[model samples]
Target: MSSRRLVVMRHAKAEQDGPTDFERPLASRGRRDAEAAGAWLASQGVAPDHALVSAALRTQQTWESVASGAGWTLSPDFDRGLYAAGPESALDIVRLVPDSASVLVVIGHNPTMAVLAQLLDDGSADAEVGASMAGDFPTSAVAVFSYDGAWADLGEGTARLEAFHVGRA
Candidate 1:
Protein backbone atom coordinates (compact mmCIF):
# COMPACT_ATOMS: atom_id res chain seq x y z
CA MET A 1 0.00 0.00 0.00
CA SER A 2 1.18 3.49 -0.71
CA SER A 3 2.12 5.61 2.27
CA ARG A 4 -0.16 8.54 3.05
CA ARG A 5 0.72 11.94 4.48
CA LEU A 6 -1.68 13.91 6.66
CA VAL A 7 -1.15 17.41 7.97
CA VAL A 8 -3.47 18.44 10.75
CA MET A 9 -3.69 21.93 12.22
CA ARG A 10 -5.91 23.87 14.59
CA HIS A 11 -7.14 27.32 13.69
CA ALA A 12 -5.15 30.17 15.22
CA LYS A 13 -6.29 32.50 17.93
CA ALA A 14 -9.58 34.31 17.44
CA GLU A 15 -11.22 37.30 19.04
CA GLN A 16 -13.30 36.42 22.05
CA ASP A 17 -16.75 37.58 20.98
CA GLY A 18 -20.21 36.45 21.97
CA PRO A 19 -22.18 37.16 18.81
CA THR A 20 -21.52 33.63 17.63
CA ASP A 21 -18.44 31.42 17.87
CA PHE A 22 -18.71 30.44 14.22
CA GLU A 23 -18.28 34.01 13.14
CA ARG A 24 -15.35 34.80 15.39
CA PRO A 25 -12.59 36.56 13.52
CA LEU A 26 -8.93 35.65 13.69
CA ALA A 27 -6.89 37.87 15.95
CA SER A 28 -3.94 39.76 14.50
CA ARG A 29 -1.54 37.33 16.11
CA GLY A 30 -3.50 34.46 14.69
CA ARG A 31 -3.25 35.89 11.20
CA ARG A 32 0.47 36.34 11.58
CA ASP A 33 0.93 32.84 12.94
CA ALA A 34 -1.12 31.33 10.14
CA GLU A 35 0.98 33.10 7.53
CA ALA A 36 4.14 32.02 9.29
CA ALA A 37 2.89 28.47 9.24
CA GLY A 38 2.42 28.71 5.49
CA ALA A 39 5.89 30.11 5.04
CA TRP A 40 7.25 27.32 7.19
CA LEU A 41 5.58 24.75 4.96
CA ALA A 42 7.00 26.44 1.91
CA SER A 43 10.43 26.41 3.46
CA GLN A 44 10.05 22.71 4.15
CA GLY A 45 8.88 22.10 0.54
CA VAL A 46 5.56 20.74 1.70
CA ALA A 47 2.68 20.74 -0.78
CA PRO A 48 -0.46 18.95 0.18
CA ASP A 49 -2.73 17.59 -2.54
CA HIS A 50 -5.95 18.59 -0.81
CA ALA A 51 -7.11 20.64 2.14
CA LEU A 52 -10.26 19.88 4.12
CA VAL A 53 -11.02 23.10 5.92
CA SER A 54 -13.56 23.97 8.54
CA ALA A 55 -16.34 26.27 7.38
CA ALA A 56 -16.10 28.61 10.35
CA LEU A 57 -14.85 32.11 9.58
CA ARG A 58 -11.69 31.78 11.60
CA THR A 59 -10.76 28.47 10.06
CA GLN A 60 -11.48 29.69 6.56
CA GLN A 61 -9.42 32.80 7.12
CA THR A 62 -6.62 30.72 8.56
CA TRP A 63 -6.48 28.53 5.43
CA GLU A 64 -6.69 31.61 3.24
CA SER A 65 -3.66 33.21 4.84
CA VAL A 66 -1.75 29.97 4.88
CA ALA A 67 -2.49 29.21 1.24
CA SER A 68 -1.55 32.70 0.14
CA GLY A 69 1.72 32.59 2.01
CA ALA A 70 2.46 29.07 0.82
CA GLY A 71 1.43 29.82 -2.80
CA TRP A 72 -1.06 26.98 -2.81
CA THR A 73 -3.51 27.32 -5.71
CA LEU A 74 -5.63 24.29 -5.05
CA SER A 75 -9.24 24.91 -4.10
CA PRO A 76 -10.08 23.79 -0.56
CA ASP A 77 -13.18 21.96 0.56
CA PHE A 78 -14.86 23.83 3.38
CA ASP A 79 -17.09 21.59 5.44
CA ARG A 80 -19.56 22.66 8.10
CA GLY A 81 -19.17 19.35 9.85
CA LEU A 82 -15.71 20.31 10.95
CA TYR A 83 -16.88 23.28 13.01
CA ALA A 84 -16.60 22.09 16.63
CA ALA A 85 -16.34 18.54 15.34
CA GLY A 86 -14.52 15.88 17.34
CA PRO A 87 -11.71 13.63 16.28
CA GLU A 88 -14.10 11.03 14.95
CA SER A 89 -15.75 13.56 12.65
CA ALA A 90 -12.35 14.76 11.58
CA LEU A 91 -11.32 11.19 10.80
CA ASP A 92 -14.53 10.66 8.88
CA ILE A 93 -13.73 13.70 6.75
CA VAL A 94 -10.27 12.35 6.07
CA ARG A 95 -11.68 8.96 5.11
CA LEU A 96 -13.61 10.67 2.35
CA VAL A 97 -10.50 11.91 0.61
CA PRO A 98 -9.95 10.38 -2.81
CA ASP A 99 -7.20 7.80 -2.93
CA SER A 100 -5.54 9.74 -5.70
CA ALA A 101 -4.48 12.39 -3.19
CA SER A 102 -1.24 11.31 -1.53
CA VAL A 103 -1.23 14.21 0.87
CA LEU A 104 -4.15 15.70 2.80
CA VAL A 105 -4.51 18.65 5.14
CA VAL A 106 -7.08 19.18 7.84
CA ILE A 107 -7.68 22.59 9.44
CA GLY A 108 -10.07 22.80 12.34
CA HIS A 109 -10.32 23.37 16.12
CA ASN A 110 -9.01 21.75 19.26
CA PRO A 111 -8.58 19.95 21.63
CA THR A 112 -10.07 17.71 18.93
CA MET A 113 -7.16 18.18 16.55
CA ALA A 114 -4.65 18.06 19.41
CA VAL A 115 -6.13 14.97 20.96
CA LEU A 116 -6.53 13.28 17.60
CA ALA A 117 -2.84 13.68 16.89
CA GLN A 118 -2.04 12.04 20.21
CA LEU A 119 -4.62 9.30 19.81
CA LEU A 120 -3.50 8.44 16.30
CA ASP A 121 0.22 8.60 16.98
CA ASP A 122 1.94 5.25 16.57
CA GLY A 123 5.09 6.55 18.34
CA SER A 124 7.35 4.88 15.77
CA ALA A 125 8.54 8.25 14.50
CA ASP A 126 9.06 11.82 15.67
CA ALA A 127 8.84 10.66 19.24
CA GLU A 128 10.02 13.94 20.68
CA VAL A 129 7.57 16.05 18.71
CA GLY A 130 4.79 13.68 19.64
CA ALA A 131 5.77 14.05 23.28
CA SER A 132 5.65 17.83 23.06
CA MET A 133 2.31 17.65 21.31
CA ALA A 134 0.97 16.00 24.45
CA GLY A 135 1.54 19.19 26.44
CA ASP A 136 0.15 21.80 24.11
CA PHE A 137 -0.96 22.13 20.51
CA PRO A 138 -0.99 25.86 20.42
CA THR A 139 -2.52 28.04 17.72
CA SER A 140 -1.10 27.57 14.20
CA ALA A 141 0.83 24.45 15.19
CA VAL A 142 1.02 21.80 12.47
CA ALA A 143 1.50 18.07 12.96
CA VAL A 144 2.41 15.73 10.15
CA PHE A 145 1.63 12.04 10.28
CA SER A 146 2.42 9.17 7.96
CA TYR A 147 -0.04 6.34 7.77
CA ASP A 148 0.16 3.10 5.85
CA GLY A 149 -3.32 1.96 4.89
CA ALA A 150 -6.38 3.18 3.09
CA TRP A 151 -7.87 6.26 4.69
CA ALA A 152 -10.85 4.11 5.63
CA ASP A 153 -8.53 1.88 7.60
CA LEU A 154 -7.01 4.65 9.72
CA GLY A 155 -7.72 4.06 13.38
CA GLU A 156 -6.29 4.77 16.79
CA GLY A 157 -2.50 4.39 16.90
CA THR A 158 -2.44 3.60 13.17
CA ALA A 159 -0.40 6.62 12.13
CA ARG A 160 3.07 7.81 13.08
CA LEU A 161 3.81 11.45 13.76
CA GLU A 162 6.44 12.46 11.23
CA ALA A 163 7.00 16.09 12.11
CA PHE A 164 5.58 18.99 14.09
CA HIS A 165 6.08 22.67 13.37
CA VAL A 166 5.17 25.99 14.95
CA GLY A 167 6.34 29.31 13.58
CA ARG A 168 5.91 33.07 13.71
CA ALA A 169 5.40 35.41 10.77
Candidate 2:
Protein backbone atom coordinates (compact mmCIF):
# COMPACT_ATOMS: atom_id res chain seq x y z
CA MET A 1 0.00 0.00 0.00
CA SER A 2 1.19 3.51 -0.75
CA SER A 3 1.80 5.97 2.03
CA ARG A 4 -0.73 8.76 1.72
CA ARG A 5 -0.81 12.14 3.42
CA LEU A 6 -4.08 13.68 4.52
CA VAL A 7 -4.18 17.33 5.47
CA VAL A 8 -7.39 18.20 7.28
CA MET A 9 -8.09 21.84 8.02
CA ARG A 10 -10.94 23.72 9.64
CA HIS A 11 -12.13 26.71 7.75
CA ALA A 12 -10.86 30.04 9.03
CA LYS A 13 -12.84 32.48 11.17
CA ALA A 14 -16.06 33.64 9.56
CA GLU A 15 -18.13 36.73 10.13
CA GLN A 16 -20.74 36.16 12.74
CA ASP A 17 -23.48 37.89 10.76
CA GLY A 18 -24.55 36.77 7.31
CA PRO A 19 -27.70 36.06 5.38
CA THR A 20 -27.30 32.43 6.29
CA ASP A 21 -24.70 30.22 7.92
CA PHE A 22 -23.73 28.83 4.53
CA GLU A 23 -23.41 32.31 3.10
CA ARG A 24 -21.15 33.63 5.81
CA PRO A 25 -17.88 35.10 4.60
CA LEU A 26 -14.45 34.87 6.09
CA ALA A 27 -13.41 37.71 8.31
CA SER A 28 -10.24 39.63 7.61
CA ARG A 29 -8.46 37.76 10.33
CA GLY A 30 -9.62 34.52 8.81
CA ARG A 31 -8.07 35.40 5.47
CA ARG A 32 -4.77 36.23 7.07
CA ASP A 33 -4.79 33.15 9.23
CA ALA A 34 -5.68 30.91 6.33
CA GLU A 35 -2.84 32.35 4.30
CA ALA A 36 -0.51 31.68 7.17
CA ALA A 37 -1.84 28.15 7.35
CA GLY A 38 -1.06 27.61 3.70
CA ALA A 39 2.42 29.00 4.15
CA TRP A 40 2.98 26.73 7.10
CA LEU A 41 1.82 23.68 5.14
CA ALA A 42 4.10 24.61 2.29
CA SER A 43 7.05 24.93 4.65
CA GLN A 44 6.25 21.47 5.87
CA GLY A 45 6.39 20.24 2.24
CA VAL A 46 2.70 19.42 1.96
CA ALA A 47 1.54 19.68 -1.62
CA PRO A 48 -1.94 18.34 -2.03
CA ASP A 49 -2.72 16.73 -5.38
CA HIS A 50 -6.44 16.78 -4.67
CA ALA A 51 -8.60 18.94 -2.44
CA LEU A 52 -12.10 18.47 -1.02
CA VAL A 53 -13.56 21.69 0.31
CA SER A 54 -16.97 22.58 1.63
CA ALA A 55 -19.10 24.64 -0.71
CA ALA A 56 -19.84 27.23 1.95
CA LEU A 57 -18.72 30.75 1.16
CA ARG A 58 -16.33 30.90 4.06
CA THR A 59 -14.73 27.61 3.15
CA GLN A 60 -14.35 28.62 -0.47
CA GLN A 61 -12.64 31.87 0.51
CA THR A 62 -10.45 30.05 2.96
CA TRP A 63 -9.32 27.59 0.30
CA GLU A 64 -8.61 30.40 -2.09
CA SER A 65 -6.43 32.22 0.41
CA VAL A 66 -4.68 29.03 1.42
CA ALA A 67 -3.95 28.08 -2.15
CA SER A 68 -2.58 31.53 -2.86
CA GLY A 69 -0.38 31.51 0.22
CA ALA A 70 0.93 28.06 -0.63
CA GLY A 71 1.63 29.12 -4.20
CA TRP A 72 -0.45 26.22 -5.40
CA THR A 73 -2.41 26.53 -8.61
CA LEU A 74 -5.27 24.08 -8.62
CA SER A 75 -9.02 23.94 -8.32
CA PRO A 76 -10.80 22.06 -5.58
CA ASP A 77 -14.15 20.33 -5.69
CA PHE A 78 -16.63 22.37 -3.73
CA ASP A 79 -18.63 19.65 -2.06
CA ARG A 80 -22.05 20.56 -0.70
CA GLY A 81 -22.19 17.45 1.46
CA LEU A 82 -19.21 18.69 3.41
CA TYR A 83 -21.18 21.74 4.53
CA ALA A 84 -23.55 19.64 6.61
CA ALA A 85 -21.24 16.73 7.21
CA GLY A 86 -20.40 15.18 10.51
CA PRO A 87 -17.26 13.17 11.12
CA GLU A 88 -18.59 9.98 9.57
CA SER A 89 -20.02 11.73 6.55
CA ALA A 90 -16.75 13.56 5.99
CA LEU A 91 -14.85 10.28 6.20
CA ASP A 92 -17.21 8.78 3.65
CA ILE A 93 -16.44 11.62 1.28
CA VAL A 94 -12.73 11.02 1.71
CA ARG A 95 -13.19 7.35 0.97
CA LEU A 96 -14.31 8.30 -2.51
CA VAL A 97 -10.96 9.80 -3.43
CA PRO A 98 -9.10 7.88 -6.11
CA ASP A 99 -5.92 6.04 -5.25
CA SER A 100 -4.03 8.20 -7.67
CA ALA A 101 -4.05 11.11 -5.23
CA SER A 102 -1.06 10.68 -2.96
CA VAL A 103 -1.74 13.84 -0.98
CA LEU A 104 -5.19 15.20 -0.23
CA VAL A 105 -6.55 18.25 1.54
CA VAL A 106 -9.96 18.56 3.11
CA ILE A 107 -11.20 21.92 4.37
CA GLY A 108 -14.47 22.22 6.20
CA HIS A 109 -16.23 23.23 9.44
CA ASN A 110 -15.32 22.32 12.99
CA PRO A 111 -16.58 19.73 15.41
CA THR A 112 -16.63 17.44 12.42
CA MET A 113 -13.05 18.37 11.63
CA ALA A 114 -11.96 17.95 15.22
CA VAL A 115 -13.85 14.73 15.68
CA LEU A 116 -12.56 13.34 12.44
CA ALA A 117 -9.00 14.13 13.47
CA GLN A 118 -9.50 12.40 16.78
CA LEU A 119 -11.19 9.41 15.18
CA LEU A 120 -8.48 8.87 12.60
CA ASP A 121 -5.62 9.00 15.10
CA ASP A 122 -4.12 5.72 16.30
CA GLY A 123 -2.28 7.22 19.32
CA SER A 124 1.05 5.96 17.90
CA ALA A 125 2.26 9.28 16.64
CA ASP A 126 3.75 12.18 18.58
CA ALA A 127 2.07 12.51 21.93
CA GLU A 128 2.39 16.27 21.96
CA VAL A 129 0.67 16.54 18.60
CA GLY A 130 -2.21 14.39 19.73
CA ALA A 131 -2.55 16.30 22.97
CA SER A 132 -2.59 19.62 21.24
CA MET A 133 -5.33 18.46 18.93
CA ALA A 134 -7.39 17.22 21.85
CA GLY A 135 -7.20 20.52 23.66
CA ASP A 136 -8.60 22.78 20.99
CA PHE A 137 -9.26 22.56 17.26
CA PRO A 138 -10.03 26.18 16.59
CA THR A 139 -10.59 27.88 13.29
CA SER A 140 -7.62 27.72 10.95
CA ALA A 141 -6.38 24.70 12.85
CA VAL A 142 -4.98 21.85 10.78
CA ALA A 143 -4.23 18.19 11.47
CA VAL A 144 -1.94 16.22 9.22
CA PHE A 145 -1.94 12.45 9.18
CA SER A 146 -0.15 9.69 7.39
CA TYR A 147 -1.91 6.51 6.40
CA ASP A 148 -0.42 3.42 4.81
CA GLY A 149 -3.51 1.96 3.24
CA ALA A 150 -6.21 2.54 0.69
CA TRP A 151 -8.58 5.47 1.23
CA ALA A 152 -11.47 3.01 1.34
CA ASP A 153 -9.88 1.36 4.34
CA LEU A 154 -9.47 4.53 6.35
CA GLY A 155 -11.34 4.32 9.61
CA GLU A 156 -10.95 4.72 13.33
CA GLY A 157 -7.30 4.40 14.35
CA THR A 158 -6.20 3.87 10.77
CA ALA A 159 -3.88 6.88 10.57
CA ARG A 160 -0.96 8.29 12.49
CA LEU A 161 -1.11 11.91 13.46
CA GLU A 162 1.95 13.56 12.02
CA ALA A 163 1.43 17.21 12.86
CA PHE A 164 -1.02 19.75 14.21
CA HIS A 165 -1.02 23.50 13.69
CA VAL A 166 -3.27 26.50 14.32
CA GLY A 167 -2.71 29.47 12.08
CA ARG A 168 -2.82 32.90 13.62
CA ALA A 169 -1.92 36.07 11.80
Candidate 3:
Protein backbone atom coordinates (compact mmCIF):
# COMPACT_ATOMS: atom_id res chain seq x y z
CA MET A 1 0.00 0.00 0.00
CA SER A 2 1.16 3.52 -0.67
CA SER A 3 2.10 5.55 2.39
CA ARG A 4 0.69 8.99 1.88
CA ARG A 5 -0.81 10.94 4.77
CA LEU A 6 -2.95 14.04 4.54
CA VAL A 7 -3.71 16.10 7.61
CA VAL A 8 -6.39 18.73 7.20
CA MET A 9 -6.94 21.36 9.86
CA ARG A 10 -9.38 24.22 10.44
CA HIS A 11 -8.03 27.37 11.90
CA ALA A 12 -8.58 27.94 15.59
CA LYS A 13 -11.08 30.31 17.14
CA ALA A 14 -10.76 33.94 16.15
CA GLU A 15 -12.16 37.15 17.54
CA GLN A 16 -15.57 37.83 16.11
CA ASP A 17 -15.11 41.56 16.71
CA GLY A 18 -12.31 41.88 14.21
CA PRO A 19 -12.56 44.65 11.63
CA THR A 20 -12.41 42.09 8.89
CA ASP A 21 -12.42 38.31 8.66
CA PHE A 22 -8.98 38.08 7.04
CA GLU A 23 -7.38 40.24 9.72
CA ARG A 24 -8.75 38.29 12.67
CA PRO A 25 -6.27 36.40 14.80
CA LEU A 26 -6.68 33.50 17.18
CA ALA A 27 -8.37 34.05 20.49
CA SER A 28 -7.04 32.87 23.85
CA ARG A 29 -9.13 29.75 23.57
CA GLY A 30 -7.82 29.28 20.09
CA ARG A 31 -4.27 29.33 21.36
CA ARG A 32 -4.97 26.61 23.89
CA ASP A 33 -6.89 24.54 21.42
CA ALA A 34 -4.18 24.81 18.80
CA GLU A 35 -1.58 23.77 21.35
CA ALA A 36 -3.66 20.80 22.38
CA ALA A 37 -4.17 19.64 18.85
CA GLY A 38 -0.51 20.13 18.04
CA ALA A 39 0.52 18.12 21.11
CA TRP A 40 -1.84 15.36 20.07
CA LEU A 41 -0.30 15.23 16.60
CA ALA A 42 3.11 15.05 18.16
CA SER A 43 2.00 12.22 20.41
CA GLN A 44 0.81 10.29 17.39
CA GLY A 45 4.17 10.82 15.71
CA VAL A 46 2.40 12.46 12.83
CA ALA A 47 4.69 15.37 12.10
CA PRO A 48 3.87 16.73 8.68
CA ASP A 49 6.49 16.51 5.92
CA HIS A 50 5.00 19.58 4.30
CA ALA A 51 2.35 22.09 5.33
CA LEU A 52 0.15 24.25 3.11
CA VAL A 53 -1.69 27.01 4.97
CA SER A 54 -4.21 29.64 3.96
CA ALA A 55 -2.99 33.23 3.93
CA ALA A 56 -5.70 34.34 6.36
CA LEU A 57 -4.33 35.63 9.63
CA ARG A 58 -6.31 33.17 11.71
CA THR A 59 -5.22 30.27 9.56
CA GLN A 60 -1.60 31.39 9.57
CA GLN A 61 -1.68 31.82 13.34
CA THR A 62 -3.16 28.37 13.77
CA TRP A 63 -0.43 26.85 11.60
CA GLU A 64 2.31 28.66 13.46
CA SER A 65 1.02 27.62 16.87
CA VAL A 66 0.61 23.99 15.89
CA ALA A 67 3.88 23.79 13.99
CA SER A 68 5.74 25.36 16.84
CA GLY A 69 4.28 22.94 19.34
CA ALA A 70 4.85 19.98 17.03
CA GLY A 71 8.44 21.12 16.50
CA TRP A 72 7.95 20.73 12.78
CA THR A 73 11.11 21.21 10.72
CA LEU A 74 9.57 21.79 7.32
CA SER A 75 8.89 25.24 5.97
CA PRO A 76 5.23 25.80 5.16
CA ASP A 77 3.71 27.28 2.03
CA PHE A 78 1.15 30.08 2.28
CA ASP A 79 -1.46 29.86 -0.44
CA ARG A 80 -4.06 32.56 -0.96
CA GLY A 81 -6.18 30.19 -3.03
CA LEU A 82 -6.85 28.09 0.05
CA TYR A 83 -8.57 30.85 2.01
CA ALA A 84 -12.12 30.21 0.79
CA ALA A 85 -11.40 27.39 -1.66
CA GLY A 86 -13.89 24.82 -2.74
CA PRO A 87 -13.30 21.08 -2.75
CA GLU A 88 -11.86 21.03 -6.27
CA SER A 89 -9.37 23.75 -5.43
CA ALA A 90 -8.36 21.93 -2.28
CA LEU A 91 -7.85 18.75 -4.28
CA ASP A 92 -5.84 20.67 -6.82
CA ILE A 93 -3.41 21.73 -4.12
CA VAL A 94 -3.18 18.21 -2.76
CA ARG A 95 -2.51 16.82 -6.22
CA LEU A 96 0.52 19.05 -6.45
CA VAL A 97 2.18 17.36 -3.49
CA PRO A 98 5.33 15.41 -4.36
CA ASP A 99 5.02 11.65 -4.00
CA SER A 100 8.27 11.68 -2.10
CA ALA A 101 6.48 13.19 0.89
CA SER A 102 4.90 10.78 3.33
CA VAL A 103 2.78 13.36 5.11
CA LEU A 104 1.21 16.65 4.07
CA VAL A 105 -0.97 19.04 6.04
CA VAL A 106 -3.41 21.66 4.80
CA ILE A 107 -4.68 24.33 7.19
CA GLY A 108 -7.60 26.40 6.02
CA HIS A 109 -11.22 27.40 6.65
CA ASN A 110 -14.40 25.40 7.07
CA PRO A 111 -17.18 24.35 4.74
CA THR A 112 -14.36 23.72 2.28
CA MET A 113 -12.43 21.58 4.73
CA ALA A 114 -15.55 19.61 5.56
CA VAL A 115 -16.38 19.23 1.90
CA LEU A 116 -12.87 18.16 1.03
CA ALA A 117 -12.87 15.53 3.74
CA GLN A 118 -16.12 14.12 2.43
CA LEU A 119 -14.81 14.08 -1.12
CA LEU A 120 -11.69 12.19 -0.18
CA ASP A 121 -13.30 9.61 2.09
CA ASP A 122 -14.57 6.33 0.69
CA GLY A 123 -17.61 4.55 2.16
CA SER A 124 -15.65 2.09 4.24
CA ALA A 125 -15.70 1.31 7.97
CA ASP A 126 -13.93 4.62 8.16
CA ALA A 127 -17.12 6.31 7.05
CA GLU A 128 -17.48 7.16 10.71
CA VAL A 129 -14.25 9.08 10.40
CA GLY A 130 -15.76 11.14 7.65
CA ALA A 131 -18.97 11.53 9.59
CA SER A 132 -17.02 12.85 12.51
CA MET A 133 -15.47 15.37 10.20
CA ALA A 134 -18.90 16.38 8.92
CA GLY A 135 -20.05 17.13 12.43
CA ASP A 136 -18.04 20.31 12.04
CA PHE A 137 -14.34 20.94 11.69
CA PRO A 138 -14.38 23.59 14.36
CA THR A 139 -11.44 25.68 15.42
CA SER A 140 -8.27 23.64 15.91
CA ALA A 141 -9.72 20.48 14.46
CA VAL A 142 -7.70 17.99 12.43
CA ALA A 143 -8.81 15.20 10.15
CA VAL A 144 -6.37 12.63 8.86
CA PHE A 145 -6.60 10.60 5.65
CA SER A 146 -4.46 7.85 4.19
CA TYR A 147 -4.24 7.55 0.45
CA ASP A 148 -3.35 4.21 -1.03
CA GLY A 149 -1.81 5.69 -4.17
CA ALA A 150 0.43 8.45 -5.41
CA TRP A 151 -0.44 11.98 -4.34
CA ALA A 152 -0.99 12.87 -7.98
CA ASP A 153 -3.70 10.19 -8.20
CA LEU A 154 -5.51 11.12 -4.98
CA GLY A 155 -9.29 11.39 -5.29
CA GLU A 156 -12.53 9.99 -3.87
CA GLY A 157 -12.29 6.29 -3.06
CA THR A 158 -8.51 6.40 -3.49
CA ALA A 159 -8.33 7.94 -0.04
CA ARG A 160 -9.49 6.57 3.30
CA LEU A 161 -10.28 8.45 6.45
CA GLU A 162 -7.94 7.39 9.25
CA ALA A 163 -8.71 9.76 12.10
CA PHE A 164 -10.68 12.86 13.09
CA HIS A 165 -9.89 14.98 16.12
CA VAL A 166 -11.07 18.30 17.48
CA GLY A 167 -9.76 20.48 20.23
CA ARG A 168 -12.94 20.50 22.28
CA ALA A 169 -14.10 16.99 21.62
Query: What lDDT would each prediction earn against the true structure?
Result: 0.86, 0.95, 0.82
lDDT string, candidate 1, 1-169, tens digits: 8888888898887899836999999998889999889888877777989899999999999998898878898789999999968998888888888888888889999888897888788878765776777778988989888888888888899998888887567
lDDT, candidate 1, equals 0.86
Q: For residues 12-125, could you state the per-residue lDDT of candidate 2 as single tens digits?
A: 999998999999999999999999999999999999999999999999999999998899998999999999999999999999998999999999998999999999999998
Who is ahead in lDDT, 2 or 3?
A: 2
lDDT of 3 by residue, 43-159 (tens): 777978888899989988888888777777678899999987898998898889877888899999888887887788776636666678767667788888777788888887667
TM-score of each: 0.94, 0.98, 0.91
Q: Identify the superior model by lDDT, candidate 1 or candidate 3.
A: 1
Which consecutive 10 residues in model 1 have the weakest lDDT in total? 125-134
Listing every candidate in turn, what is its Cα RMSD in Å to the true structure after a full C-alpha superposition? 1.3, 0.7, 1.8
Model 1 steric clash total: 0
- Best-fitting candidate, scored by TM-score: 2
Q: Model 3, residue 97: what's the lDDT?
A: 80
> What stretches of model 1 exceed 4 Å from their correct place?
none
